[model samples]
Target: MFQDLDATLKALLDDAAGPAELQAADVSFDTPDKDYKPAQATVNLFLHEVTENRTLRDEARVMERVGDGYTSRMPPLRVDCTYLTTAWSAQAGALKAAEEHHLLGLALRWLSRFPIVDDRFLRGSLKNPPQLYPLPTVVAQTQEGRSNGEFWSALGIAPRPAFSVTVTLTVEPFDQVEDLPQVESIQITSTSIPDPTLAGRVLDHALTPVPAVVVTVVETGAQTTSARDGTFIVPGLGFGVYTLSVQAPAKPVEQVTVTYAADHQTHTVVLSGP
Candidate 1:
């Protein structure tokens, strides 16, 4: 990922800084020695530090559906890579300082134009596999590299003008995960059972049918009173075990468990009491 960013920056500089070719190299802050000879201009991108973007940190695990099971994986980690960018010139003369300063200005302008590097500019493995967003780029003064005095002192070199570039990237986790079971579809089976009809007659002790006797299904709370003929019928009830309750005047409550059948015929019950 760092290599990709560096290459992209180099491409941008080479395209913008015309006439003189600029090469991006991983070098220290100390100016190149007299024995070393580089192109007319060089952009040194020194990766100095890396910091985690805590705000992008997430505790929730990522889940994906694979076939009949779900695969779990850790969330991607976000980090900011800081690069110390220093422009150099091979020319040695009174105008060498001015030439290096001019090259640096051009590099800064070119970098400023791209606050974010588009995905098309990305190369290598970064172009495929894990999905990533356009990298955000920022050229600014860093607290650690406030001045050339302290910055160059840390590198054990003379002071020189330089800027900081930070590119934020999202990196996937290195761990592998196993797929787990997940419910895909639920199957419901229905039988063509006949609806039930409960019918009963209420009678007094004299064996005469008693009208107005309330017959209720205890499970469903469905009740019906006997007609003038002392007969009651409840239809369209599902086939199941139910408690049939019979109540009339001057008679104690009676309850009986009846397992309804699929015959679709009326179930008859006879009740007689005081």
Candidate 2:
């Protein structure tokens, strides 16, 4: 993958320098040190740093439909590759500095024209498999807190006029994706809730309204007291048969059975005297 990126950049520079007749200049990826010498004009792109682009990091998995099923895989990892670009000239005296600066300027300007590396210049695996996302480019940007002087000193070479170019690439970590079966059908069921009111009146043996009498449903243990008018109501009753127990002051508890239905009528329970 790294080699593909190197080829892509070389193709891009070669195209850019073609019109200027600078294509004859050699494009080198060699380490520029004290003993390094070039026989002709050269443009060197030294890959110095490679780091993950945290800003473009994605943790979500990508899912795609495949026939009757689906396949899911993790998103590709985005990485930034930084290159220290410099130009070398074999010309002597003042001509050397002028020619090098001119070459560097042309490379910088042409690369800056594209925020993304053009597809026409893509080479190797970059063109074969094709990139998942466009290769983004950053030209002539300052390296974070990195001193060019220190970099050249470490390389045992004198500092030269140059620029930085960064390109972003996506890497797929997982090749095998998980396959999932598609849903065929769905089922839903619902039931109606019972919300009926069981109402009735309490009476004495004399057939007179009897207040202050307790009425209870034996099946559900639901109870209610007779109102001043001898009326009582038990809510939330469903269709079924239930035993009613009635209790009056100083009287024996009386028991009666009643059936609750959709059209249940009011029931009258007669209590015995003490």
Candidate 3:
């Protein structure tokens, strides 16, 4: 990817500084060194640094539907590529300085006009199928609190006029998975649950539990006898409204209404007069 970026920048410079014939080089900043021949003009673009563009971070993963399955992939990573671009002319004296300045000026204007590298100008591996998108180029992006004096000194060359070129590249993550199953069809079946339950206590006028009282559901003909505690529970009744009659010694038939649901239902019956 970096090589492709280098190619793209060289092509742009060549086109802008016509006839000067600029070529991208991997040489040090010092132009007078043996690495540079004092023969013709040269444009050196050194990839000084690279860092991830944290601000452009996106969703960690993305999903795509494919036929009967889905594919998941981590989103592409964005990186900032920094380049130090300097120009040189082989000849000495006024002519050399003039040529170098002219080259640098043209390079600056060309890069400034193209804040984004056009798709057509993208070269080498960038033109490949995998990398379909064009990289964004900027001439002098803000590098907070940083200086290049050490950079020049380390290169063993005196600092000259140079421009910083920063390009943003998107790299797709390699971790991807395909062919996860999807829902085919949904099958739902009807179920009849006998959950209805009737429960209550039989009490006399004295407010005391009356044991052995019989409770009957008139609609369903369901009957139950009260236990020692005067409580009766009729389980597994169907859902519907029902009338219940309580029978106790010397007690008139006390009528009560009950609405049974899919859940338990309760009704209290009181027996009084003889």
Candidate No. with top lDDT = 2
TM-score of candidate 3 on Cα atoms, chains taken together: 0.58
By lDDT, the better pick of 2 and 3 is 2
lDDT of 2 at 41: 89
Cα lDDT listed for each candidate: 0.67, 0.84, 0.72
Indicate the TM-score of model 2. 0.66
Alpha carbon lDDT at 43, candidate 3: 70
CA lDDT of 34 in candidate 3?
A: 35
lDDT of 3 by residue, 1-274 (tens): 7877877776776564444434342223333333555455677677888998898878757677898778877777888898888878877899988988987776676678787787777887777754524577778665889888888788777788888889888887666575556756543322334444667778776556788888988887889899886788887676788888888866667887777665536555667653
**Where is the poorest 10-residue window by lDDT in model 1?**
21-30
Clashes of each: 0, 0, 0
Which residue pairs collide, candidate 2? none
Give per-model TM-scores.
Answer: 0.55, 0.66, 0.58
Model 1 gets an lDDT of 0.67
- What does candidate 2's lDDT look like per residue over 171-247, in tens digits? 88789899887866442322233545777888776667789889989999999999887888888777789999988
Off by over 4 Å in 1: 15-39, 65-69, 144-148, 178-274
